[model samples]
Target: MPPSPTPTGPRIKSPETLIAESGADLEGHGLKRTMGLFQLVCFGVGAIVGTGIFVGLSDTVAEAGPAVIVSFVLAAITCVFTAFSFAELGGAIPVSGSSYSFAYAALGERVAFLVGWCLLLEYGISVSAVAVGWSQYLNELLDSVFGVQLPTALSAGPADGGVINLPAVVVMAMAAALLVRGIRESARATAFMAVLKIGILLAFCAIAFSAFQEGNLTPFLKEGAGGITSGASLAFFSYIGFDAVTTAGEEVKNPRRNIPLAIMICIGLVTLLYCAVAVAAIGALGADAVGDKPAALSLVVDQVTDSTVGGGIVAFGAVVAIASVVLAVMYGQTRILMSMSRDGLIPRVFERVSPKTSTPVRGTLIVASVFAVPAAFSSLDVVVNLTTIGTLATMVVVNIAVVALRRSRPDLKRSFRVPLYPLSPVLGVGFCMYLIWGTGWTTWVQFAVFLVVGALVYAFYGRRNSRLGAAQAQAA
Candidate 1:
């Protein structure tokens, strides 16, 4: 048999070199570093506190029973591990593509392409899923004030027995228009939504506590470790937005210092909010009440207060809350595409920025177009599971990327470091894989099928155009 051709010679881009390349203004990529620490924190909070808190909390409570509080902590712990790696890399590279860029710098080109594709899938599905959630709340608000409702045939997707989700598609298009305006504008909008949602949450908490019963906390381990783990696995979705902050590596001021700080601060705040909401919810309404309803929080509030006003307030917040998530997530998606485009891993149109807006105009439009159909026709359940699988896949790649980068470039500047070194990343890998497994065999098959498709795309397109490959060829 002919000896297999020895694979050799493509030099990995060092963090310093990639940093320098990005420092060349994302290679003229238009994202501005105008966002300060406060805005960055707001972005993180905006992204982290959305759909999961508003929609997934009910399912989480059901999964773990009243013991769901433990699920919250476990999910946060896992994200913190991955967040440390994100901080280190975001600070070290300070680029647009989050894990894809990190993987390219650390693991090499082919792997980075895969990571980027998964991220594209992850962020895209997240935006669509959040938009669907938004539609539910929008309809609720309309019904609350005007006593009118959208038809189920037009309001839901295939998974939910609807012909198409009109509101979901419309919401995504609106977000796309907002994003195309400019990055600063997008940040301001997200920050405003962040404050609005947090205030609404605090308001919910104040009311929820009034009806809290100590007996609700009795069967804390109602589902046992398995249940808690399952709940945690699902709850892990809440933390996905934290990494969305890293996609702004080029947009944040003092990214190296601020990225890590913002990550910690946001994670801390989200964790506290989740715990308070979960504990109060289970205590006040019991685990049985928080169902698969899209407007679960609003319903929870209505039960706690006899007045329609409380529910109205929550429904109002849900409108802004899911929008905030969609905004941050869509922003992350565009930036990731822009980054990959800058790297020649995707089409050049995704790399083009509006000179007027200093944002990736073409890329933003593509993101809007890509998810519009799915948002209109697919079930929220299908999109949400796909998003989770993509999230887990991204986290697993990021964990390994951190470990690889640490070994390959010990001298690179990292303003933030993972505390336990190998343990943090190793555990990040293990826990992410475990959560992926717990997502069930069906999700695994779905993920595998997606990756297979991604590999084929990379082979046909990204393989030849890869910037790293070109550089390697020139050097050789």
Candidate 2:
């Protein structure tokens, strides 16, 4: 039986209850624990390695010039700090909700609802951003391989002077279909794609580095401090998926051990690849050529090798990379909603798992459909900035939640702990704030509006129907 709502103040779920219920959910007909450490890392890498690298780099490079390499490093530093906090909480709670579950256990229901809302902006919007990037690469691949390209009407959105971005919508639908099949199948596909994309990126670096010139990197900081900070803000988008690994807590084998380890490993591995690729791209083509090229990497490869074959290979890899991002990130989004729905914060439909597939099919489709519309109409930059702001907001809460959990649940056993404890989390919060500060004023306004809307939604619907409030009412 479900509890009926009653007015109640803020409430936090105990770590013990959160862990126990999560375990039960996994044991019963909920999500299956099929992912191991390898698949887990692959999932993270797949999520983090897309869009920002293969497509958004043009803007990032344009923002920071050759010094975009420095922007990547700065963004990685911020992610590393926050990733530590996530590693600690994820290992302890091991829930499908990721940061939202962490907040519920440490920050109470209202804050948790908002964090979940921020995640909607993060993962949901990111699906559109990644899909938009995938469409560009798809066009690149076709033009290289078959000497034909998707017409602007079909490939670009209204923001890009096209009626609709059909390729973006098509790719989003494809990823959603794969997700509805099952988690095991999705993880396997992501892992294969993860490996293929990494190989392709490395090959791109090898070819590009051959033509690397010292002169190309001479005026690295042409855009100055403002550019680096703004570029870092954009670059932070690249690391969005690392935390998605933690969202798989319920689906991963031995959550305590694998979750933390996978997160740390994913961040370290991706930071290296991003920096190397940025350097190779800038060095080969110079910052001027790199700027605003939708398929910058493929263009770099083409110029370096003076052949479309080299460009074709990199384009193919990007298509695989961005597609995997849509799959993995959408999976994370559905799980977050499922956690919320189970708490009676949203409709129960989101929490229901299919008897046949053991996956939240309805929730997955709902998320994909809602997000695909944005992919069809909005530009890539618009969705990417929205995703970055939303992501940074959730991470700030996650960092604070880690500190609160440490103080409140001193006895809770954690497989991992953020090194330096308070300092690490504080730095995590600071770094996240710094990136958020670098964002354009317009994005901040949008984020403010988003928060206002989220507050209203929670107040009108989430607050009145919250499962925690019902539990408290019963206890009283």
Candidate 3:
């Protein structure tokens, strides 16, 4: 075997250097660091509290019964572990890419590209999936509020007995438009949607809690440990967007302090909301009824409260919440691609900035195309499984990167550090692995296939085309 050509030196720069290099990128074509802690909190909250609560809640309830509360706690713990790692890295780097950039700096070109690809899977699919869900709620709201019923074929995706999902595609395009206009405009729109969604959730909780009966608490562990584990694995998707806040490292004022605070605060707040909402839902409808529909909260409200008004409000909230999720997830995806393209991992088109808007328009459009097909024809189950696997895999990489960076670059400055050092990162990896295991054989198979494809692409294209490699060769 030809002594496998001694692996070339790492093409990518270290995170510290990347941070210094990013100053130029942040100057003209990027967003201003004008967001205060409060606005940052709202961004985190807005992104984190979306489609998961609106669409995945019933799925969790069905899997774990009232034990969904336990699932939420378990998922939150897992998220905290990864979130701490992200805080440290984001603070130290404070760059555009989230995990993808961090992995590139800590790991290497191939690993970074893989991580970036998986994140593209995570965020792009998430946006499209959420958009599809939003379409359903939008149709429901239209029917309830305006007595206008969209044709079933037009309102649903092709796989769901529909020819096309017009509302979903339209919403995705609208979010893209907002994003291209400016970051501040997108943030303002997200803020409005976030407030409206939270208000509806609180209203549902208030009403549901008032009607809570002891009988609904029966068989709390209905699905046993296996079921709770499954639920936790699924519920983890709900917490996925908390990392989206960290992706705004360069856009937040005092990112070192504000980013970490936003991550921790958002996780805590979203966990509380999820637990409360799950409890209230289970208390009102019981596991059986909640399981009947994937979008359970809205269904439960229609059954328990005044059907007309209650259902309308829940549907309206779902519309706003899912829309916000699409916006945030798409934003995260485009930014990661932008960073990767800049580093020469992906095509240069992804790195091209729109002169008028300064956002990566080509990158955004590419991601939209990739996601649109899946959203237009696939089931939510497929999207959720793919997302979970990609996210868990990325978390494991992030956790390891944290420990590796600690060892390799001990002198590197960081605004935030995982409190227990190796322990926190170790637990983060362990938890992520456990959840990944919980995702079932099919999900594992799919993840494996995706990784294989990613590796092949990197070998054929990324290795040679990488800007990092070109830079290294020039320096040599």
Best by TM-score: 2
The TM-score values for the models, in the order shown, are: 0.95, 0.97, 0.95
lDDT of 1 by residue, 47-110 (tens): 8788888888877887889888888898888888898888888888888888888988878777
RMSD of 1: 3.6
Question: Which ten-residue region of model 1 has the weakest summed lDDT?
Answer: 1-10
lDDT of each: 0.83, 0.90, 0.82
What lDDT is reached at residue 189 by model 1?
Answer: 94
- The best candidate by lDDT is 2
Clashes of 1: 0
Sort by lDDT, top down from the best: 2, 1, 3
lDDT of 2 by residue, 299-332 (tens): 9988888899999999999999999999999999
Candidate 2: pairs in clash? none
Model 1 ranges with Cα > 4 A deviation: 1-7, 24-29
lDDT agreement of model 3 with the native:
0.82
lDDT of 3 by residue, 76-182 (tens): 99999999999898888888788888888788778888998798667888777788888878877887789898897877766787888777788888888788787
